[model samples]
Target: MIEIRNLTKSYGRKNALDGLTLSLGHGVTGLLGPNGAGKTTLLRCLATTLAYDSGRVEAFGLDPSQASQRTALRRRLGYLPQDPGSYPHFTAFDLVDYVAILKELTGREHRHREVRRVLAEVDLTDQARTKVRKLSGGMRQRLALAQALLGDPELLILDEPTVGLDPEQRMRFRALVSRLGESRTVILSTHQTEDVAALCERVVAMDRGRVVFDGTPGGLAATAAGQVWLSDKPPARSQLFWRTADGRYRTLGDRPPGAEPAEPGVEDGYLLLEVAA
Candidate 1:
């Protein structure tokens, strides 16, 4: 449903997105990257919040750079930014209702009905009347999510949606996102490997402002297949080595003579990509 070609964006002397090209179809696609991997930059560009320096970006078969087309695309798109601003004095219900209006839900009865429905979807119906300042961080995140789901947009762009969520909250979010992807396209940009593994059918890994890997979760994991090994101690010559919870050292790179081959995971492949780049 989305197509990007040679996308380039810069900030001062640095290039945030360089020669990035990607195409997404129906279903959930996970965007995995490090802090400066241009994940947020790409999301903003797609949301039409930031303009790219060059390249073509098409959403639902229309170019977003054009004013009229951008407005039309926004009508069918839902965006949950990294930090969705809030008014502490506004209650959860009030905040979502305001956003509904911005989305052009004009009729009083219809807007109210949609606000309540989305609040319930995010499991915030009981806290509908609670002030934003009184809610927990996780609650606030869900409140933001409720606003994004207001119009039931065709394309959902979520950036770090699980940041403040607890384990249970994150699990609920995964289930909700998975369900949403059944009929529409969901683009999830996150640092959480497990989230991608559980909720996405396809994965895109980026580094240095460009996509380095685009494939299935298993295919990404296979990038590090025979490169990862486990041993009692950290391997001195390994490119990347870390101690696991089981008190063994999992190393990526040239295996030591006594190191046993260990199954590769999403994180392993991601780290390997970082090192390779």
Candidate 2:
């Protein structure tokens, strides 16, 4: 579990996180936000990879601001950053093994077992021996995930973990994350609304560095209830209308005369929230 209160972080004059307060328990919670919405900043703060300008952050009853507690918190959490960076020369196994050691896996044989286990979990077993530079983008992303899964931490912070993944791999990741969430807390930050709809039990939307909405996936979709309508053509003067796959115009705004009310989904509500913000 994690708790935050009035957490604020800034980069010079820009506030990355502004008076953010949140509590997370065991389950998959999707963080939905557009660029510059502070999702990554919040995740980094939770991971203790970045320090905030103000407020408190505690995970599993330990304060991450303290040196000793920060170490302890790190031991109980796994983080996959937005840009995991490149390890060009290291093989997939080596990359994970390096991180496992950092996570304090001291025994060689045991560490190797863990490295292979995590690699397999990410479906990168076949490329375990391949060099990082030679792996495909998706394979490299999975390799980053392998390092994050090194110790089976209680909390997992994933920022754009599905980036570059094919549909099949994304489904595999959803299944794995869903299974993990049964016992621990997983905070998944992504732009992919479909993933949130499919995997997250709770959804949190942020805008301009603050929490805008927090609720269940269905509840999020319901935020757009009665606001979404379908028509053969977009409503004149409507700013939020898009062509759908069915050749109909799906518009989110005040209803147009004769337009049919369409069922709202997670993305529809999220978009409406963004526009309002």
TM-scores for all predictions: 0.98, 0.98
Off by over 4 Å in 2: none
The RMSD (Cα, Å) of candidate 2 is: 0.8
Which lDDT value does model 2 have at 50? 97
For residues 197-263, what per-residue lDDT tens digits would candidate 2 score against the true structure? 9999999999978999999999999999999999987789798999989899999989976799999
Residue 265 shift from truth in candidate 2, angstroms: 0.4
Candidate 1, residues 179-215: lDDT per residue as tens digits? 9999898998999999988989999999979999999
- How displaced is residue 100 in candidate 1, in Å? 0.3
The CA-based lDDT of model 1 is what? Answer: 0.93
Candidate 1 residue spans exceeding 4 A from truth: none
Candidate 1 TM-score versus the reference: 0.98
